[model samples]
Target: MTIEQAIDSVKKGCKAKFDSTVELHINTNLDVSKPEQTIRVSVVLPKGTGKKVRVGVFASKNVETAAANLSESDIAKISKGELDPKKEFDVIIAEPRFMPKLAAAARVLGPAGLMPSPKSGTVTEDVEKAVEQVKKGKIEIRTEPNAPLIHTVIGKRSFSTADLAANFGEVMAAINQAKPSKAKPDWIKSVYISTTMSPSALVDIPDLA
Candidate 1:
């Protein structure tokens, strides 16, 4: 189907009570067994992800204190488990030096996708900028470790068709830019868009091209 049709289908399929997030799913032709073919990266959507992101920063006290949005007190709260990683924050950003401290909470943060990593731009020297970017709708996109599919939220079902289409275009651009050197020309196999509880609508790859 055309991109506009896919977006319209996603909006129409949302039967959930809350504003369901519109998600983009891409299946690639990469071999999941090969480490070199793995895809992992982040991008800032132009229209934002249409989700409120609570950011947690792991950094030295000095850096936290210096940070404009993240405060030292907040870091302390996270470290002490006062702020539950899963419930309190949607994403976590950390400085390289504080990665060791973050390791201790891996069991709690890892499964929730709240762990900071270099590939996601969450592990950075510039903690303040990272936090700001995340607050402004920076999202990470990665192929599943065991599958060739990549999934990410593009926007909410409440968004207008134009807004969703714009966000969808940004995600496609980022995915194309992230094509691994080892991947073939037809690396991207299929793309779909859907709301949280709706069946997916297939998007025409040629139109996106």
Candidate 2:
């Protein structure tokens, strides 16, 4: 199916009262067995993800003060554990010095995909910048460690076709830029788009190229 068709299908099939997310599932030919083939990157969607992102920052005096000045509520949520990685915070940013503190919560944050990592642009000294980017719709894309599939939310089902299409194009461009040098021509095997609860619609891979 074409990109337009996929977006139309996803929007029409969405039945949720709240704005449901639209996701892109990509299957690549890269071998997951090779550590070098693992793909982890970030991209800012042209249209935001259509969800309010609650960001958490782990930092020392300077960074913490900067973060608190930006959003005191977010800092409180993190310190109070009210922003449970699994349920509250959408993304977590950490300064290098605070990496040790994160070790204590690794068991909880790791599995929820909320753990801050260098590859995901979440582990950095610039805690304030990272939080700002996330609030502005920066999203991380990573291939599953055990599989060649990469899944990420592109936008909301309520977005206009043009907006969704623009976001889709940006994601595809980022993926292409991240292509492994050792990967073959058919690196991207297939692409599919779907709403949070709807069946997926296939997107023409050739068109993406």
lDDT of 2 by residue, 10-116 (tens): 88887788788899999998898998897888999879888887776666644442223323444455456765656656777777776766666676778889877
lDDT of each: 0.82, 0.81
Which portions of model 1 show Cα errors greater than 4 Å? 61-84
The list of candidate 2 runs beyond 4 A from truth reads 61-83
How high is each candidate's TM-score?
A: 0.86, 0.86
The deviation in Å at residue 9 for candidate 1 is: 1.3
Each candidate: how many clashes? 0, 0
lDDT for position 32 in model 2: 83
Clashes by residue pair, model 2: none
Number of the top candidate by lDDT? 1
